[model samples]
Target chain A: MVPIYYYLILSAILFSIGVGAFLIKRNIISVFMSIELMLNAVNLTFVAFAHHWHQVSGQIFVFFVMVVAAAEAAVGLAIIIAIFRTRATLDVDRIDLMKL
Target chain B: MHLVLFFIFGGLCVAGALNLLFQRHPINAALSLIVVMSSLAVLYLLLGAEFLAAAQVIVYSGAIMVLFTFVIMLLNAGREDRTHGSKAAYLVGIPGAAALFATLVYIFLSYRTPLGDAGLGNYLVTTTDLSKVLFRDLLLPFEVTSVLILVAVLGAVVLARKEH
Candidate 1:
């Protein structure tokens, strides 16, 4: 079996990439996807640790996280649609209605 | 065998995620995310969380990404326009992220041995065992999530309606 740390390291690299994507991306949808990537990375850690401790709670938490991500996706995309309706653009920089 | 599987799936996930970050179009980025999520599902299976592996594929790569794709299509979102932020990010953001990843890798590597190997025993966690824990111990949170999903349903309907 591969060491648990290997999973941890893989997740770490993923989390960093997610963070980088979140910071650099301008589209609202891409940014939202990056957030999902970060969440997935965290879920990986949760599952790895759950296995390490031989407990079921970590997997359960992962279940909940997935549920939450689903809900967030619904609400978030709705907001994105609303934003597009109003601003006529998906670019994060252009959606600043409060800047005036 | 597991190690080889991990390498292939893990490499695919990293590459897909990088593509997601660099892609100009939102549709392309969304597709890349689907790749990442699907690969993570396989990793979950290898890690002994078989239920999660299935759910990750069903819920994440399937349902959630479909929602994203639907939005991208409905909204007709364009490719991300290049801005001044790109230059600043290329100069500083990439290095900062690399440094953070390096630090994380170093810390985990250094502590891994002292923590000892094989905290995971030979047994793989099964779906039945997982469900028992979920319904028995974590019941409240489970119920709350259902309510949360209900609220999200309402919120999406309310928010997405075309106004007069």
Candidate 2:
């Protein structure tokens, strides 16, 4: 049996990595992937707690999160495609029109 | 045996995430994310969420990642040029994230005793039990999510339509 803190620690580390990646990545798609990473980390935390407390609701919440993530991915990628079509670029730095 | 499997998949998950962080090309980053997601599926299995493990594989690594790669190839996106990105990200963001991680680790470690240990095979959460709860108790939310999915489908179609 592994201590539950180990899973929590791993989740925290993954989340931090996700934040760093989201901040640093320039490409829109890469940034989008970082968001996915963050979502996955949160999902891990939910599952860990679900297992810890012996609650099926935690797992069910994860299921809803996944459903939302799927919808988000579809819409987000579509938005990315729209942005690419308009800007002709994927770099977040270059895509800024209202930054000024 | 449980501890060993946890460490292995956990290590793989972290490594894949780091790989996603450092990769120069969007395609490479997407692939790394797939690795991370798959490793996470295994972690879900380790945590006794069997249905979630399968869903993580099918939904995340299978569907979402394929969509990402398809976009990358369709757009013909190239490796990121590092020069245009702001310096503040490295200067502030890395330390900020590290600080956040330290804080969370400390908090979790402090509460470790109450959290306790998880032993496998003691009580597994079977799918039948999950469906009973999901369908019986949470039926409304379930139906709402289907509506949400339909809206997402419509939104994607509308958004991705070629502008006239």
Candidate 3:
């Protein structure tokens, strides 16, 4: 059996990459993808801990996280679409109107 | 065997995430996100989280990614002119991310605490157990999540609807 540390390390790398992409990417869609990446990274950690502790609670929490992520994605994309319709671009830099 | 499979799925997840990051086209990015999600689902299964693996697939790959794809198609947000930002952004972001990765790696590696050998052997929850805990203990959160999903759906519809 592989050690749990392996999974934890992998999850950390993925989460870091996701955070980097989310912060540095200029495209709205790319940012959205990065957010998904972060969620996946969290899921990986949840499963690894669940395995390590030999419990089901972490797995159940992961299910709820996925449910929330799905709903968030739907609403987020729709809002992005609405913004794009008005702005004609998905560039994060250009959508500075909301920035006060 | 487990290590090999772990590396395989881990590679898939990393590759998919990188593709989503570097890919310019929204459709390609969306597809890559789906790949990432599916591979993560496999990882969940390898960890014995069968329910989580199924939820990962059904919710993320089937529902979320599809919604993303539709939004991409509806908005036709395929072509985006690159936005201008300071070169310092990448320099700072990369190092910040690397630092965070190193910290997490250190924590994971240095934690020498022994995990109890308690096993869930033959303790898999049946439908009754699932319902009992879900309805009895998690009922409030469950109801909140349901309302949240409903609100999100309504918000999406309102946002997508054409202005009169």
Docking class of 1: medium
Please give each candidate's TM-score: 0.95, 0.97, 0.91
* lDDT score, candidate 3, position B110: 83
Q: Better model by lDDT, 2 or 3?
A: 2
The DockQ leader among the candidates is 2
- Residue-level lDDT tens digits of model 2 in B1-164: 99999988999999999998889899999998998899999888888999999999999999999999999999999998875464877787799899999999999999999999988865578899899999999999999999999999999999999999
- In lDDT terms, how accurate is model 1? 0.89
What is the Cα-based TM-score of model 2? 0.97
Candidate 1 residue-wise lDDT, B1-164, digit = tens? 77788899999999999999889999999999999999999888887888999999999999999999999999888888888776786677788888989998999999897544432236488889998888898899899999999999999999999999
Ranking by DockQ: 2, 1, 3
Candidate 1, residue B42: lDDT? 88
Between candidates 1 and 2, which one is better according to TM-score?
A: 2
i-RMSD of all predictions? 1.8, 0.9, 2.7
Report lDDT (CA) for all predictions: 0.89, 0.92, 0.79
Expressed as tens digits, the lDDT of each residue in B1-164 for candidate 3 is: 77788889999988988887677787887898899889998887777766667778888899888888877787777655554562566788888988999999988888735532213232343445546667898999999999999999999999988898
Q: Residue B118: error of model 3 in Å?
A: 12
Give DockQ for candidates 1 onward, in order: 0.72, 0.86, 0.60
Worst 10 residues of 2 chain B by lDDT: B82-91
